[model samples]
Target: MLGLSAFLESGRGDKLSSPVKQFIQNLLKANMEGPYGSEWPAEEKVKRREMVAPEARYVFVRIASLGEFLTTSEREKTAASCVEERGPIVGFVHFRFVIEEELPVLYVYELQLEPRVQGKGLGKFLMQLIELIACKNHMGAVVLTVQKANSAAMNFYLYKMRYVTSTISPSRVDPLIGIEKSYEILCKTFSNEAKAILEEPLELVHSV
Candidate 1:
């Protein structure tokens, strides 16, 4: 296995590592099949690559604002970028920076992975990196939105990353029909050691 430090170091250029770029492309291709029962246009995938860098390889989600309602954007200026391991570009995340309760927070704007790497635990690895981001920035937690039906993602956050399920709601894109829920808010430190005790992995006991 590659060390996290080595994987983190692999990120450069567009904040994407070589491994991450390949992952994002695969994700786009697989999901390019589109939504429930609908066909995702192939040309659209081409357009997505054009919008984001062709070689992007990391997955960092962000938030943004446009018109009256909030929206998602990926173009980076001075804030953050996601880089993977293989090279400089493959997959990437788009996000907006904001404050919550007077603490710096990242509102996961958007995320994507390469098709070939979706089920190989990349998401979990990326999320742990977010914890480092929170600690480095002196923030309380990282927040993101997931569609209610994305059960696989829900399990990753609730189980692997130790995030709590908060509330269930709908999204703007067909908000009335489908629901979007927020999950996984990590506190600066464990609020309750007892809870932490039960949650802590046996292997990590030595680290503590």
Candidate 2:
């Protein structure tokens, strides 16, 4: 069975081959069509390729064949060798390390899974892996933006994963004022310093 350890990581400035880029594009188009496409125009959706090309780094989960797995050292020999030959990518998570509200965080730009792979606990495992990466890198939190129209994602993050709407997030600051936004920012904090920044009421923080 394919496991989390089998997934391959891609980082900044890594030139993804055409097949890999296509794999990512297909997943993004399929997953974001419902809410994001509705909110943004068709042209904007098409333009996402250009936008996503530069900033995104990825963890790619590809299909593994029975009794054909290679050791991690062997897999690193080639860029795409770790991925299955002529097989569809199972899923990918795009993220970057950045500073938000003056705190360092691992910011998840996108997470997409094929319909066939949904509900197999892979998503949760990927999230746990990212959180571990964040802690190891001394990041204060893990953060992501979710479209308000995507109730499934909202429920998954807020209810199942215990992520909270960040204190400085527009919606958390003032729902009425922030309702103009199409997305909500959420975070899972790992440090007391980060929790203090993200969990306190904005008014209280300002008053102090």
Candidate 3:
């Protein structure tokens, strides 16, 4: 993946400052509220709780002026200067490493981007970095939830990124229930067991 050249900065959720936290909330609301619709209130509550989890991890994309690069490497290069130099937080991915159906996985909880940055290839770059992280940690797979209503995001993951709707996704397990659900679980597996458990449909898993 042609990445950020170290422009992407990562940190723990617990270390996020008040201003950074506020940026996340505003960005999430701006980027996701529409797809969630009336479920936004409940989903927002869930998001708030998840964002502060002690183990949660983040990849923050800071504001780089039109022709300038913003990061510790390019800026003053001190911990404090990195924070003070980068203009603002414009995008971020919140994720965690956790056990899912007995398999260790990297779960992406949120991927939010500012509207102005939407078509600039940053989203795909971030996902590639996330997948690389999963592989480095020997995670069996990288998993995420995508709203059915968010067609752009759905396309980006399912088609562009080659992620599949996981077998555990509501629709895959039970079509009837899936019809009523708003989101789908998607995964990219690195092992056969994970492929069977997460990528194969429930019926196929039962037969095998």
TM-score (all chains, Cα) for each model: 0.46, 0.78, 0.86
| Count of steric clashes across candidates, in order | 38, 0, 0
Could you give candidate 1's per-residue lDDT for residues 115-207 as a string of tens digits?
323555556666666666655765545656543345666666667776653222223223444333232332223224322332344356447
Candidate achieving higher lDDT, 2 or 3: 3
Q: lDDT for each of the candidates?
A: 0.43, 0.73, 0.83
In terms of lDDT, model 2 sits at 0.73
Lowest summed lDDT over 10 consecutive residues: which window, candidate 3? 74-83
Q: What is the C-alpha RMSD of each candidate to the true structure, in Å?
A: 14.4, 6.6, 5.3
Candidate 3 structure quality by residue, lDDT tens digits, 80-150: 32254665566789999999999999999999876655667889889999999999999999999999999
Q: Which lDDT value does model 1 have at 62?
A: 22
Clashes of 1: 38
Candidate 1: 10-residue stretch with minimal lDDT: 62-71
